[model samples]
Target: MTDVFAGVRLLGPPETDGEYIALSEHETVHLHEYTRIYAVPGLYEHVVQERLRCTSPQVAAAGFLRAAATLGLEPDSMTVLDVGAGTGLVGELVRHGGVGRVVGVDALAAARAASLRDRPGVYAGYVVGDFLHADELREALRPYALGGLVSAGAFGGTHATPQALRNALAVLSSGAPVAFTIDERWMDASDPDGFGAAVEQLVADGRLDVLERTRFQHRVTTTGEPVFYQLVVGRTG
Candidate 1:
């Protein structure tokens, strides 16, 4: 019985479902193995929160609520589109934020299945596909007139490519808000083509405006080291 992905604690003897590992050799696993990871039941949670101590979902959701409050907007009036909604954790957070309708999009079918299996009714609709394409998904959610976007811990190296951001930006209604968090290490103020610079351009060009950004601990790596991320809330201007 081994829980290879369940954080640093050497829990009880590994059951058939859990993969146990020694403390020294744990940093090699990739993060997107949703099927293998989710199949272990509570491994994702244990690894993400118990082990890594990830808090992006909760932080981003709370920031969205506060920004909405600052604008005198009702959270219940928001129709939210959650991009890369792995396991529906972020979707549940948005629902808890009082969003009127939630549409979840993910590239992996296993993610959708896990969401339905573990957190049914948390999302109004779940679509499985690449979110970088706008045309196919546009009509699927047209009825909702989506006013907000939630993409917690989704944007990254390849997933957060400029083209992807351009496309995700195309799916929103003007003036709609978008909230997300990205690893701070992936960003740089001096690097002109960096993710942080791109997002800052989106804000400066009047396409968006940064409402709030807080540097916080997102979680831990397989090696028992803390990983930090920035929770960012912005609006389509």
Candidate 2:
């Protein structure tokens, strides 16, 4: 817990009995490995923003705002849906940007608990279930009439798949705006991972606009290496 906005410094992951832990750090900490980090209230911030200098939440929110401005739509009029919402950090930013209502969907119950613990009143409703698995998720979302979907730093991971993205989008109104960011490696054509194909299809078929995309310093790795990611803002037209 240090001055996060000021700078990023390297700090190795928690150790027990001088044993080495196998944890990979990209801009912030790894999402999948949340158990060790989330045990401490602010340790996630310390490792992600302070030590690793991850700016994904901020960048993702900014990208959504930029797209809103371009479309001449006020953020306050939009009903926001945060897919893969981790602890409601990105939702907080979106709400601050004037989004009328915000709902968060996360696979882990820990995410919902952490969001309520860390940032209450940020999300109108927080659901604990995988979008791909839970049937109640769709029913719960029906009342929101979501106008925009903002998912930052939470795509193509083990929790989120192309099928899940398709399901999430299926719940939205037609041409709903969607903005998200992911590591650029996911965009590589040579990669056997299906992410490249999914993203390409989503963009090509007017399922995603892909308006603004830029490579920026997402955060530093645990080994003190800079991690770059592509932040994309777009409409789902």
Candidate 3:
């Protein structure tokens, strides 16, 4: 693929809070400003996937497939809810992995538009709503009978919060699978995101039965350093 980001330059590693410079436009944008990134077709793929080498989508999909297999479930028999489904990257992977249906949920209209524009038909439906305030969305999703949930690269900093995760979990049927990946730091006990404590409580309270938790390099930073993320696969208890 041609380098769509040839005029874009990434500076600093993730640990140092990386920033990007668009040489052609002479503008600086944060690495996490996904709305702006998705506005330009192939810019996100070029910067995040090609340049930084993000692999969360593939890793999360594989984890979800493994968890489904462990539960004696076939992917084609499942409908999955994809939280933070940015540009349908994860949803496309899950759909190609044989999921019967994939519904995407993102707070940004730009994300939904980008998904439809780039990977048309990947998601059976895409809803724009805050997961924390999704009572109507929950009711609307009932018809899909979502059997699984997957989130990738959407659980830290200004992204989805632990409460959003809990809200997503509330919609899944008992025993339905859930898979997600987050930066390892965010999983640390002291992290302000509260994802670590929330996950622990879910497991302790028998709300989710964790099947696998693996730490892997989620991506390479702009400086070519590794950024690790933890992939957690589980089933609702």
**Local distance difference test scores for all models:** 0.73, 0.75, 0.85
Report lDDT (Cα) of residue 205, candidate 1: 81
On the 0 to 100 scale, the lDDT of residue 39 in model 1 is 60
What root-mean-square deviation over C-alphas does model 3 reach? 2.1
lDDT per residue for candidate 2 within 1-237, as digits (tens), equals 454333433445455321122333434444346755555566567666665678989999888888878877888988888988877889999899889889999877777888888888999898877767646789878778788888887776555776777677777776666778887777675665556677778878878877887888888766666777887777776
Give the candidates in order of lDDT, highest first.
3, 2, 1
lDDT of 3 by residue, 149-215 (tens): 9989777657878887788888998999989998888888676447888899888888899999889
Clashing pairs in 3: none
| Model 2: number of backbone collisions | 1
Which lDDT tens digits does candidate 1 get at residues 131-219?
A: 56667777777776777788877777656565566577777877777788888876676777667887888877887778887789887
Measured with C-alpha atoms, the lDDT of residue 67 in candidate 3 is: 89
Prediction 2 global C-alpha lDDT:
0.75
**What C-alpha RMSD separates each model from the true structure?**
5.6, 5.2, 2.1
The residue pairs in collision within model 2 are 27-219
Relative to the true structure, candidate 3 reaches a TM of 0.92
Lowest summed lDDT across 10 adjacent residues in model 3 is found at 14-23
**TM-score against truth, every candidate:** 0.83, 0.83, 0.92
